[model samples]
Target: MYTGMRISEICNLKMVDIDLENRRISVVGKGNIYRRIPLREDVVYMMKEYVEQEREKSKFADSEYLIVTQRSAKMDRTAMLTWFWRLSAELGFRIYPHKFRHTFCTRLIQLGVPILTVSKLVGHSSPQMTARYYVKIGMNEKLHAIHLL
Candidate 1:
């Protein structure tokens, strides 16, 4: 939720990809491009705790992947989807992994982050691509724009 990483990127994340001491994560996005994302303090703390307490308890703790499945050492797309489906059912709402990426991009744009910066963070090839697809301008924003005129 914090990082605008694609579902595949998240699933493919390795322990080496994360630098908790440096507060950053390296992900390979589309086209096998690599990018480093800075982590917030809260996220870092949570990750630290998860790694130390929860992940360590798993039988697959030695897995190279940061996220491990109870049945397998590595988490794949199917496992991720199944998990999301169960969570959605339990919560009585549709929840998917990509929703986090979308929310991450939308929240950053809504917060007045530069389109170029948001685009880069989300791994879009261009700001125009991000603007065309993910930049949602709501009724409130339209009203605010008209008032500014």
Candidate 2:
């Protein structure tokens, strides 16, 4: 939810990819491209807690992956989807992993962050691509723009 990484990227994240001290995540994105995303302080603390307390107690605690499953050393896309599905059922809402990516981008754009910066942050090849696919100018934004004019 914090980092706008793809589901595959999140699933493939390794312990080495995260630098808690620096408050950034080194992501190997699509086409084997690399990008560094700054992390929020709260996110850093949560990640640290998850790693030191929860992940440490997992059966696959020695796994190099940041997230591991009891059945496997790494958590795959299927497992992630299943987890979201269960959460969705319990929460009485349709929640999916990709939705978080969309929300991340949308929230940044809504906050008036530049499209180019958001593009780089999300590892998009171009700002146009990011604007075309990710940026949703909602009715509220439209109303706001009209008021500004």
Candidate 3:
């Protein structure tokens, strides 16, 4: 979700979905429609390392899935949720899987990114959806606006 992709989209990501040279990932969103999202430099590096070092060394080295279960099969949604639950318990904080997507969108909006751009990046159907949900006005922004007056 750090990529602002839904958990299902992430789980469904395959080796073919990524274009490392171009730093982009193609994913099927809510309506099974394909959308492209740019990957950050760090994310590109991580993907490269994961595909080469970790995935290559795994027993299911030939698996096309981006992320896999211990058996080398694609990880199920339930497994992902269980993993997050265990992680939250270990970290002593609430960790909802969907919240990562929210955080990604919220951070971009908070950083003053254009709503249309943010919506496209996160594969939202329209800018309206992004603005309605993720674009929040914080106190700092309010104070800055007041100061500008």
Q: Which of the numbered candidates is closest to the native, going by highest TM-score?
A: 1
Q: Which should have the higher TM-score, number 2 or number 3? A: 2
What clash pairs does model 3 have?
none
What is the C-alpha lDDT profile of model 3 across 1-149, one tens digit per residue? Answer: 55888889988898898999999999998976678988889989998998889877778777788897776468778889999999999999989778989998888877888999888888888999999998778899899999998
Model 2 scores a TM of: 0.92
Displacement of residue 4 (Cα, Å) in model 1 is 0.7
Q: How much is the lDDT of residue 134 in candidate 3?
A: 85
TM-score for each candidate, following the candidate numbering: 0.93, 0.92, 0.88
> Could you give candidate 1's per-residue lDDT for residues 1-149 as a string of tens digits?
99999989988999999999999999989987678999999999998998898889999999999998888888899999999999999999999999998999888888889999988887888899999988777899899999999
TM-score, ranked from best to worst: 1, 2, 3
Number of residue pairs clashing in candidate 2, backbone atoms closer than 3 angstroms, sequence gap of 3 or more or interchain:
0
lDDT of 2 by residue, 1-149 (tens): 89999999998999999999999999989977789999999999999999999899899999999998888989999999999999999999999988989999999998999999999998988899999997777899799999997
For candidate 3, the C-alpha RMSD (Å) to the true structure equals 1.9
Model 1 lDDT, residue 48, Cα? 91
- Steric clash count of candidate 3: 0
Evaluated at residue 115, the lDDT of candidate 3 is: 92
